[model samples]
Target: MHGRQLCVCVCAAWFLAANGEDVTCLSEYYMGREGFRSVPLSPLVYTPIAHRPDWYWKKIFQMRGIDPESVKSGYTEAWLAFLFVEAQEAMTVCSIEGGRYWDCILDVRKVYDLAQGSARSTFAGRLAAVFGITLAAPDPLPGHLRLSLCAPARCTESQVVQEIFPLAVDMLMGERPQQMLGNASFRDVVVAHEVAGWHDFDIDFAIVGVNRCGTTSLRKNMELHPDVVIKGDEEETILSYELANRLLPLKAQVEEYNAQVQERITAKFKATGHRPHIVGIGNPLLFQSALVRQKLALMPQLKLVLAVCEPVGRMEKIFMMEKYCHDDLPAAQKRLVAWPYRDGSEVCFPSTSALLTERHGQLKLFWDQRIATAQHLAALAELFPSRLFVLHQTELRDTPSNIFNELAAFVGLRPFPEKIVFRRYNSVGGHRTDLCFNASLVRSLQRLLEREYVMQESILQAFRGIRIAARSTRCDLVDKVDTTYCPNMAC
Candidate 1:
């Protein structure tokens, strides 16, 4: 148990007298007790409901435009509607940039005017009509140019417009949140049947871990390949945390996802008459979830990818996200000098002194997250030794095409169809680290690495580019710190 779960699992013990002998009854099992998931510390209760009948689910998929079996050829230039299949009512503001891979950024305005006022150009017409869009139909009205959908129990349009839409837009587009505010270059643009094409394909692999460690840029570059189709949002996924931690025993959602994957194969067979070789996603946070073992148990053939960067550099990225994940960088930068570790920011951004107390636990947890990667890797090793691939961020940044070619070869993916021009979407980390670095804190942080040393070392061996407390790395205070506690520390 990492000891930071927010679920309220209330337990109380009552002493009872049964024929003069004291007997105890307890409400819940404690951590490390039997019947608990060892890693997440959540109760292990995965009783998949018996398959009663799924005759209607296919119809539901067809109705939702997820199963595009009926759409004929020449529908190649079709659009993807951002569907909220579950919600009864929703609102979305969708903006589109055309072509194979489009650049789109959505913003919810109290109302903003279009670029060409009242002009009759087709793009402008579409923009004017969709500016205050409302999605009421469970019936998906997909056409040539749509990319977002949502339905939620919102009290007022004001509530949906002002709060929910922007949050959803930011997440769906950035694959990470609030990053759209700074970079206009982040996108994975499709989430439905029309534009994704009816090519029968199986998910060949999963990029599961080391979040904030170049997984975003990695997923983007890989997606650029003509052979790859990212089924779900790489940044925020329906397949990662939601699939792993379903707090209810109602049903296993993976069954439906598995069914959808299978249907894609069947759909492609009917469409092009040839099955495609690959479809995959990167739900980076899944590497640490209780679902790791559960997923392997279900899809044992699944290949895993972990992006590794120097630990401290990874933490510095973590620090940036914690401080500014919700706010845009320009606006956030304005607030920086005024409120260093401001009041409303995430808890981890506590003042420098707290680095010894509250921040100590936070920093420890961050490294523990890195340590947890070892546990997942060990499990993958036992299951299938050759199934896991480690991609180092340093290598990816320095020589984009070469590292991509190596990963592509490992995963059976074709090479990039064009010249590999890699662009990083998050530039906030390039700022001055003097704003948040403390040498003692970094040294102490490296001390915590001892717990996961052996496991981390094995992974480092697998990927030579993996650096530990190296002065050449991008971490906040590596050069400034007097010493690194990690053994064999080198650039």
Candidate 2:
């Protein structure tokens, strides 16, 4: 699978095993430049986390004290070197080639008989970029090129090698390869993870849905639930993509996700000593991908909370968002990724102001966009009715206390404190509190609300069990008129 399979031959090595057959790395099939031979396997395992660990190594420092944090974080090369000086094994395996250490990040023979696939094609190029050395193309089986990298201040060698090891193993083993070499970060968390019976993420819930809704506030409330661990920002852009990649197989994606998060959540567990049962990402844009409508399908067991408001209000809030709020947006749209729009085709503007100004003409695009999102929501509800929850943004704004407590129970977590304060993380009705919709927009907005809004009891058709917030989706128009905020102008 790694390289070309030449003319078929009856080789005993190719005989079927329970899992799969062993790969035969042939020299003629494998491509290489000039003559490259075997390089002995270097003993260097995980790269030191800190780059300048050599600086700290000294017998003089032994008389003084070593920093425990530095050692724990893999920056104690000085202490380690002092210990290993007599053995000379470490010195034999590694060397100060130039000014910096070119630690052996890859030895092709250990994982495979030959340099193949990504290791064959791009490994040399990547090593050159990172360590600044152009290498001849490596050969097969007998050996090719070995890639060693000199890291900057931080060592990403463990991450880079770990990605390669698993993918390349499948070619040799025929089925799959279990990573023999452990990531230093992964090693730190394995014991704690097993003890806690936790997977990558400990918590059981996620807040996935409409922007400008109370998704932020809901997550914050959950964090206050006595024993909970919520990592990173309100939007988990990294973790969300892994969960929603339509192209990648679930197992492969999960293993990669595990490799990443195996360190993240469990590290928090180690620090806090409280094994939080409530740990999950809260990203509002999870279901926005048209290609992967079933984003929640990635974690089917996960209890999903989607907070949605009346369509007009949500859009209006974004339109009225303070300029200061859009401060982080770039001056010009460099790429489609600048905005987390559904896909590459969607119009991307630099700022919220630009989006509102340019795309205001496509106001009725609201129904198409939201209705499609609602369909995605409906599909998830059908699949995991007991697990999927639709939270009414109107209700959350109305009765924050009750909504929070009930939501905690939904996720099988304890409620927030009885006297705890509930604050809105995102609420922007700055420009005009009154509705400014014309008659046509008003009618369209209501239909959008009734079809999708949990408050109207319309979405309840799919999700029967949820905390309902009784709030009036009605406000007087700014044009000296009274028209309802919700669909069908009812309440």
Candidate 3:
């Protein structure tokens, strides 16, 4: 009866010591089973009993029939010995849990104090000298002793390793720290670091431009490539615009923006079964020089694709689209009029006659920046050098296969599918023939924009020379339209 009573008492004490508040630890035990059952010790509850030598002695004798006096006479030395053994066991478990092979001097003295002076300089030093881990004291807590175990540099490459290393070290030092394996806060830190690395590499290119050009069509076709992942809608304008405007600190905004982008790209790659080689954004408003500079500063390796059309045609399309809104779409007209312009002029969609007559100044100001498409592309080419790619809007419309093939090569993609079809998207509709003005007014407007026309011709010649040199042999897929349409019409 006494032996059975003693066995129950030992089991109960061992159970409590092994698991402080965890109910799951008790699930493995069979109530009426014979002999001893193995109950894995919880690292959180198992602190080395250095301060309570008498209790340690009793538990040791009860569990393993080892007399404390026979093992060692000095209490401090025995305690250090016990801690050394526990550290070894903890490190072994950590290694099994994905820690790399560490090779450093184990400095337990940095973590724990001994009455016999530094543990590194004593018998503890001799015992730990043969191991690969170095134990050091972490930042001291006010009411607790904190220890950190560091392995070789290569061991911490994994996010799991980064999280588990600290917890395992604390456990080895008998700190009884909380488990952080699946904790959200800990996981966020790991993810943030991973996202930072991801951002450094993923945004390989951008299609920044003049708004009315064929950016939408180019982006849509680019998305069809297996190795490309361009956002389906318009580019993420707020990212570049707000950052360039300095509404917030640059670093913080960049991190926040890239984190959102990274999530999307990750999900896309997971579903597509092929990792995207180049992720791009197509935001026409990013053509603003200030925004372009800001983007370059953020990603110096960014490849730029500038798509430009005849300035007058683009401006006319923009004006006609506005007119359609004002005359036919009342709700859209209300919204359009309320939209803010950088020049502080009231937004208006005047009749074509009024636009060519009274409101010409506002129209000129609105299209002036865009009309100088050659200057913008030249400036960007000078700034970005080989990283810049200029695409003619006409080619995008007439010979899309050739343009897309060239674009695919420029942005580092395998040649797109041979049977690829490029369809015009987001083309402006509802343009009225009555929007055309008198031929005298058209000549006057052409003379006003003559410099832009010359620059546009120069850019077309430059791109043509480049294409011819590259030996791009694809046949033009669509018939060429009269180039004189824009110059002849009062667009």
Candidate 4:
């Protein structure tokens, strides 16, 4: 009786534990892990397609010897049909049993190698990095017999497929073809080609980040110099995350998007009356996202200028200024936010944390997968070398003269103009934050920020170093425009 009672207790405990957790797998943890491995999450989600059926892929072993049913379930119609035809052709060239396997392996390796350096590398690397495991094909099975599906585990087969789906596809696709992968720019394709061969790059520079950094300030200042043509913004992100989701092994969507963006910028300069010598795109958010690094690897000629601010202060600025999150909140709930910067107006809070994890319709899941500051910054720096230029709020206010001069030179521009204009907005520090959150809630946030940034000396140091470097290198001639009121709704 005691034995049965103890067993019951054990079963109950297991049930309770299972019931206590969330359903979806942890994504942010994977993201942080990917950063450490110098890979981003996008690429791992897709892989190249191959020529033959069960030719060289390890996943073929997991499924019984390639049956029609197995092939049908493994890939989409276009990709699978193409593979089937290719397999038939490859078999004719070298029987599946003979030298064909070695040929297949060699071919797949080339494609994999090429993608390893481009955005795809970071994408696939991200998964490998997060799981803290390397992706290696299982050794080929013995000649006659095939691995069978016996009693299966409780997990669904789909879960298992998602895991090895990428590698399986790559084995089917042979070498990296000449055609551009989907819409990937020529610049990015060139980078991938170079990386595949493991060669040095002559890339001019990189913008490196997406949006909201001092990149705007840097770009504006650089624009004044006769030598520079500041490139406008484009959806470079579509190339990284969206295109990575497809089944076409030859198509790299993210690269295509960036290529188009770059071309447009280049064309804009070519069409103009007086084309500038130095050309660049200032999309600050790109630095925060993995896509920028991938794009940078391709356009080696493009120099990089990254403007960084204190993470805690930046987050605060984002939250108080209302960058992107305002769209999600209801107008009634929005009105609750009182902006001290403007009279009787509402401000936006940038963090989506409240929506993703909050008790209301939004803000709940937002905090659930909030990316860490150190992780975000490190990911960008890892992708691009010394091209990044950092700027800080404190540094700008403290040593404006020296910092401005250094910044100008870093971007290969002229000296700073002694007098400059700055657009002034109401100081947030003095604003009454009472309507923002209750004291207890504010305390909780403070603790969160302190835990996230204050303890991270490395990130702080990187920020400081970038700022000092920019100041020491460039010349600043930005005239602070009039008090440019941040649109209340936009903030």
For 1-491, candidate 4 gives per-residue lDDT tens digits of 25653453345446535878321222221222222222211211223334333443444333335544444434443333343334233322322222111111112223333443353444344434433445443222111111111111221333212211222222222222222133432222221210110012222344554233444445454555445555454422332454333212122333553455466457656776545555555555655443334435444455565545444334444444342444434552345333324332433344434422342444433343233454556665555555556555445445656766776677676775556533212223322223233334444554555543432334436644431322211111112222223322211
In lDDT terms, how accurate is model 2? 0.44
What is residue 172's positional error in candidate 1, in angstroms?
A: 48
TM-score of 1: 0.46
* Model 3 Cα shift for residue 72 (angstroms): 83
Give candidate 2 regions above 4 Å deviation.
1-203, 239-273, 290-295, 298-300, 319-367, 430-441, 447-450, 453-456, 461-474, 477-491
TM-score of each prediction:
0.46, 0.47, 0.49, 0.43
lDDT of each: 0.43, 0.44, 0.48, 0.38
TM-score, prediction 2: 0.47
Model 1 Cα lDDT, one tens digit per residue, 1-491: 22322121121112223334212111112231232111111112221222212332344344556644543221111211112111101111111111111111233220122212322133233433443333333122223232332223221333233222333343222222323333222122222211111111145777776776777676766766655555654353554445343222112344555566666556655665656557677766766654343343344356677776665555554555453243344455453422234555455343433434644465667545656666665654454556778766667657777878877887787676556576654333333344245666666655654444456556656654455433334545344544322111111
Provide the lowest-lDDT 10-residue window in model 3.
469-478
lDDT: worst 10-residue window of model 1:
88-97
lDDT of 3 at 340: 25
Model 4, residue 404: C-alpha shift (Å): 4.4
- lDDT tens digits by residue: candidate 2, 1-491: 23222222223224423237322222211221011111222222223435323332332234346654556554233434433231122222222221112222234334342335654444444433433334565432223233322212122334323322233223333322333222232222111100000132333677777666777777766676655666564476644454332212223444554454556557666976656656667777765543233334435457878777665656545443321123233421121112333333444333333333444464446435655655666554555657777777766766888878777778777777787777665443322322343444445555545645543355553464444432233333233444223211112
Spell out the clash pairs found in candidate 2.
57-78, 139-144, 203-279, 446-487
lDDT of 3 by residue, 127-182 (tens): 23323223233222112322223232233334223333333343232222122222
